[model samples]
Target chain A: NAGVTQTPKFRVLKTGQSMTLLCAQDMNHEYMYWYRQDPGMGLRLIHYSVGEGTTAKGEVPDGYNVSRLKKQNFLLGLESAAPSQTSVYFCASRTPRTSGKNTGELFFGEGSRLTVL
Target chain B: EDQVTQSPEALRLQEGESSSLNCSYTVSGLRGLFWYRQDPGKGPEFLFTLYSAGEEKEKERLKATLTKKESFLHITAPKPEDSATYLCAVITSSTLGRLYFGRGTQLTVWP
Candidate 1:
């Protein structure tokens, strides 16, 4: 089973360009998140969705937007890419904590490498 | 603000050498502490989770122990394949269960 998959594994964009990264998960998790990884900054959250049709800004949401229109897909958009946005992006999803199970672990996608010039 | 910090930004050890990586955090109402291993050009993989202080979990040669303020990932008799970046993250009561990650510790086990 494909747990989590990301599209456009690698991409390059000039400054002021726009693009979207797609993340699809088969786990049917209720929580999905977008994160960016840089050399020393580690992985910083960009945006997240607790359920379909819901989204919330994260620590580094300045130049990014996100949508979770479907239960299985979460899209991250760069409205106007900039050099500072060059970083590897990762998508993760997790099951909710319920009376039957109280776990907080995330399953991640392979990651998308984006470079803005 | 919640914060997670990992120490010894990088480490190199000979095969069979035992060592430990540290992760410290400052947050209120912590829900859980997690450890993840990430290979180059790949995403972070879940390793272990600690729910409360004084809890410990072991897998193969790796062991994770948690305290009120910090956690430790201990590698016993390491192998070259154990080389990777180890990340520490935490979930707090106020985050809506969202995770906050640390800078990570890069470990290299030489043969």
Candidate 2:
């Protein structure tokens, strides 16, 4: 069972270029998230979707846009690449939120490395 | 602001040596704490989740214990395959699905 998968494992883009990273999950999770990891900083959230056709901003959403057209796929778009946006991006999915339990375990995809020059 | 801090940015241990990694956090209302392992060039993988103080979880050779203000991931007799970065995250009451993560501790177990 392919839990979570990401496309374009590696990419290089010149400044002002645009690109999209695709993430697909087969577990039928209701929550999906996009995060970026840098050298000394831990993974920071970029955007998230609670379900199909729903998206919301996360901790670090600047210069990034997200779409969840289908329940199993979440796409992250970089309208204009910048040097600061060069990092390893990860996609994660989790089960729906309940009252106060249900261990919030996130199944993550192999990261996509993007370099903005 | 809610924050998470991990100590010993990196660690090196010989085979059979045991040690612990620390994750401290300060938040208004804590809902849950999570531990994840991440290899180089890969995404973080889930390890354990603690909901309240004095909670403990064990998997293979790793043991995670939680307190009111911090958590500890203890590795016992680790092998080379146990080398990875350990990340700690906190879920607050205000945010339902959001997680705040720490810088993580990189561990290397040498044989």
Candidate 3:
């Protein structure tokens, strides 16, 4: 089974443009997350969802919006992309049973690279 | 505020040489500590999880140990295939499942 899949493996967008990144998981996990990795900055959380129809803000959520309308999908939207928003984005998910036990081992997507010019 | 830090931004070792990476964190209440290895242009891969201080976990050539304020990832007899960035993250008890990640330690092993 495909554990996690992210759409648009690579993208180049002009400043002020809008785009959406899609993440789908086949594990039926209750928790999903969005993170951005920047050079020397590591991975920073953008937004997360505990389950379908729920979303929460993360460390860096100012320029991003998230929707978890279906249990298998989580989408990240950039209203007006900026150069600072250019980075490799990763999506992750974990089953509730493991997550409740505090074992934070996550199943991650390959990643989506976005470049804003 | 919760914070995680890793040391020696990068490391290089010979095929048979061994080394260790450090991850330090400060959080309100600890739930678990995780270790992941990431290759260039790929997502992080799960390695180990330490639930409390004084706990240790081992896998093949890697061993992870956790403490009250820090954790260590020890690699035994490295190989070129083991070269990658190692990341450490902390999951707090209060948060549902959010993880705070460190900058990560990049390692390269030459054959």
Candidate 4:
């Protein structure tokens, strides 16, 4: 039951560096989301994908980019890492809200902690 | 504007104590309200979902009740394992799968 898995459980990057966070889900869900968790800020959505090739920006999408090229994968990219971008990133996936039994239930990954200096 | 708020940023309780955590929201059209439990260095885990007013759900030592404007998660006889940050979120008409989250309430149950 590898619900959702994120790569590079921990990472540290220098300013101006670029990296990608990979998220994979085996649940065959159609909705994938990326959110960053900070103290006193809860979890703010960064970007999300509705299907295999559709992506949309969320509340805090200034410094992040996302792509969903396949149904099982969603990738979050940071072109230029900043100290302010240091946060714990969580990836979640859920089935579409098409059925009464499967509406608005999100399965999340363990989380990836990133540090920038 | 849609917003979700959680009261009492942090709470401390002795083992076996009972209490409630509050989540308030003001959204255009409420689709669903969600509760999650987050531990240190981990992502939030789904707990319960309330669809409309006057709905109640219970699991183990936690019972959740919802109204039009707010929802309450009542914890009965909390144990140390129940200590974690409780998060509240909402999905409205403007958001399909996106969730607007509250700042969360950190709970500590000392044994």
CAPRI quality band, candidate 1: medium
Worst 10 residues of 1 chain A by lDDT: A96-105
Off by over 4 Å in 2: A97-102
- Candidate 3, A58: how far from true, in Å? 0.4
Worst 10 residues of 4 chain A by lDDT: A96-105
Could you give candidate 2's per-residue lDDT for residues A71-90 as a string of tens digits? 99999999999999999999
TM-score of chain A by itself in each prediction: 0.96, 0.96, 0.96, 0.96
CAPRI-style grade of the A/B interface in model 2: medium
How large is the interface RMSD of each prediction? Answer: 1.2, 1.2, 1.0, 1.4
Clashing pairs in 4: none
> What is candidate 3's lDDT per residue for B1-111, written digit by digit as tens?
788999989999999898899999888888888999999989999999898899999999999999999999999999999999999998886775698899999999999
Give the TM-score (0 to 1) of chain B in model 1. Answer: 0.98
DockQ (CA atoms), all models = 0.74, 0.70, 0.85, 0.72
lDDT tens readout by residue for model 2, B1-111:
888999999999999999999999999889899999999988899999899999999999999999999999999999999999999998888867777789999999999
lDDT of model 1 at position A52: 97
Error of 1 at A102 (Å): 4.6
**What TM-score goes with each of the models?**
0.98, 0.96, 0.97, 0.97
Candidate ranking under DockQ, highest first, comes to 3, 1, 4, 2
For candidate 1, give the lDDT of residue B94. Answer: 91
Q: Give the TM-score of candidate 3.
A: 0.97
Task: For candidate 3, write residues A6-115 as lDDT tens digits.
Answer: 99999999999999999999988999999999999999999999999999999999999999999999999999999999999999998755545866879999999999
* Model 4 error, position B84 (Å): 0.5
Q: Write the per-residue lDDT of candidate 4 for residues B1-111, one digit (tens) a residue.
A: 899999889999999999999999989989999999999888888999899999999999999999999999999999999999999989888896688789999999999
